[model samples]
Target chain A: AQSVTQLDSQVPVFEEAPVELRCNYSSSVSVYLFWYVQYPNQGLQLLLKYLSGSTLVKGINGFEAEFNKSQTSFHLRKPSVHISDTAEYFCAVSSFSGNTPLVFGKGTRLSVIA
Target chain B: GAGVSQSPSNKVTEKGKDVELRCDPISGHTALYWYRQSLGQGLEFLIYFQGNSAPDKSGLPSDRFSAERTGGSVSTLTIQRTQQEDSAVYLCASSDRDQPQHFGDGTRLSIL
Candidate 1:
């Protein structure tokens, strides 16, 4: 089984400021890394994914995550944030192959203040 | 034309009552998944279905919970004699087994 832990539970940042959300995983086998965002009363939206290839993977809305194999971490970063970025962020992991279920972290609430 | 959709966006039931939640996946998605989200808790996988076959049900909390997918499209999660702990948001997602999943708004189930 795979497990993920996001370091922060709440992050309040001023708009246009840089932000980073740390995530670490525990798994004996290889797994896929993913980051999803959820707004109020809505389901999650995929932000970025780390399948293979480039260590740094970028996704929608200026979000990026770097896959560090040695540390078993895939941390999401954004150079600048907007107030619209305020939402609950989740880091999830699953097996690279087979029918594996996603194991998610508790969640990190990003409050982008103006 | 539409994304994953779930019926009865909000459901309120008393403890000991049975409740069913429905999920309609994308037209061509071959894989569907069900997850539960409780207050202050992250999304927890409950069951998985791929092209009409299910191989994972380990995340289901107990035997009181069951789910079935028909025609590889629509799925229903049923909770028998629901308990207070059953209150949470139930989410449905669908993919083609190789693509990113699309999710529904989810159905919030509240047990009184």
Candidate 2:
């Protein structure tokens, strides 16, 4: 089984400022990591995922995340945020074999202020 | 290309009534998943279907919750005797093998 923990419940940042949302996971075996964002009244949108190969993975909307193996962390980062970036961000993990369902974190609400 | 689609964007029903939510996965996707989002519980996996194999019902909270996939494309999630605690967003996702899941807008179920 895998479990994810999003360190922050809410993040407030000014527009055009850099930000990082922290996430950590615990698993007895290898796992895949993912970041998803959900806007108001909308479903979750995939931001990025770390399956293999690279430690830094980039995704849509200028978002990126780094998968740290030793630390068991996958933190989402953005060089600059926009007002539209305000949303609920979730971190998830699943077995590397793809046989297990994703285990999600409690989510971090990003509030990008203008 | 169409992403996953879920019907009944919003559903309001009285407690003890049964409700059904539908999902249509993207074309050719062999895997589909169901999740629940609530205030108390953030996001929770409910069920999963992969091809013709037996669906994974491990995440289902209780026997009152059930789901079925027809033709390996469309799925229906049925909730029997709903309660106020059941009010939440039901999300559906689909993906190809070894691919990231694409999500639907979800059905916001409100039990009164």
Candidate 3:
């Protein structure tokens, strides 16, 4: 079984400032990583995913995450955030094989203040 | 092309009542998934359907929760004897093999 942990429950940042949402995972076998964002009253949207290849993966809305094998982490980062970026973020893990259901963290609420 | 579609954006049901939520996946998507999002919480997997067959239904909370997919296109999740704790958003997602899943707006279920 795989599990995800989002270290921060909430983070407030000024607009145009950089922000990082930390995530960690535990899985005995290989796994894939993903970040999802959800706006108020909406379903989740994929921000990015790390299946294989480059350790650093870029996602929509100027967000990126670096997959660290040693740390067992995939922290989402944005150089500059906008007010529109305020949303709940989730970190998820899936099996390396396709069609597996995702295991998600509790989630982090990002508040971008102007 | 249409994305995933969930019917009855909001559903309110009384305790001990049965509620059904429907989902229509994108055209040509082979994989469909059901997940639940409780207030202020992350999504919990409920079931997974590959075509018309569900290979993984382990995530279902209990026997009261049941789901079925038909023709590999539409799915329905039914909760028998709804409880206040059953209040949450039920989301449906679909994807091609090995691709990122696309989600629908979800059905907000409120059990009173």
Candidate 4:
């Protein structure tokens, strides 16, 4: 089984400032990582994914995540943020193969202020 | 449809009542999944269907919860004798094989 852990429950940042949401995972076998964002009363939208290849994966809304295999972490970061970026972000993981279910962490609510 | 579609954007039912939620996966998508989002539990996988066959159903909370997919297109999740604790947003997602999954707006189920 795979599991995800989001270190922060909430993150508050000012517009144009950088932010990072921490995530960790545990699994005996290899896994794929993903980040999804959800606005108020909306469904989740994919932010980025780390399937394989480059360690740094870029996603929509200027968001990116670095997959550190050694640390077992895939933290999402944004060099510059906007007020519109405020939303609930979730870190999810799945097995590298098969019909594995996506295991998600407790989301981190990002609040970007002006 | 352009994306996954879930019916009855919001549902409010009394305790002990049975509720059924529907999901229509994207055309040609062979994989469909059901998840629940709540304040306490966050996002929890409920079920997954791969062309009408459920290979993973361990995420279902209890026996009161059951789901079925037919014709590899539509799916329904039924909760028998729903409890207040069942209140949450039920999300549906679909994918093509091992590709990224797209989500629906979800059905907010509130049991009073």
Best-fitting candidate, scored by lDDT: 3
Clashing pairs in 2: none
Candidate 4 chain A: worst 10 consecutive residues by lDDT?
A94-103
lDDT string for model 3 (A8-28, tens) is 999999999999999999999
DockQ of candidate 3 is 0.70
For residues A1-114, write the lDDT of model 1, one tens digit per residue: 678999999999999999999999999998888899999999989998888899999999999999999999999999999999999999998885324577899899999999
Candidate 4 lDDT, tens digit per residue, B2-107? 9899988999999999999999998999999999999888899999999999988988999999999999999999999999999999999998867888899999
Candidate 1 lDDT over residue span B18-37, tens digit each: 99999999998888999999
Candidates 1 and 3, the one with greater lDDT: 3
Clashing pairs for model 3 are: none
Candidate 3: where are CA atoms >4 Å away? none
* Each candidate: chain B TM-score: 0.96, 0.96, 0.96, 0.98
The Cα local distance difference test for each model comes to 0.91, 0.92, 0.93, 0.93
Clashing pairs in 4: none
**TM-score, one value per model:** 0.97, 0.97, 0.97, 0.97
Candidate 4 interface RMSD, angstroms, 1 decimal: 1.9
**RMSDs, each prediction?**
1.2, 1.2, 1.1, 1.1
Over A1-114, each residue of candidate 4 has an lDDT whose tens digit, in order, gives 788999999999999999999999999999999999999988999898888899999999999999999999999999999999999999999885325678899999999999
DockQ of 2: 0.65
**Superior by TM-score: candidate 1 or candidate 4:** 4
- Predicted complex 1: DockQ: 0.60
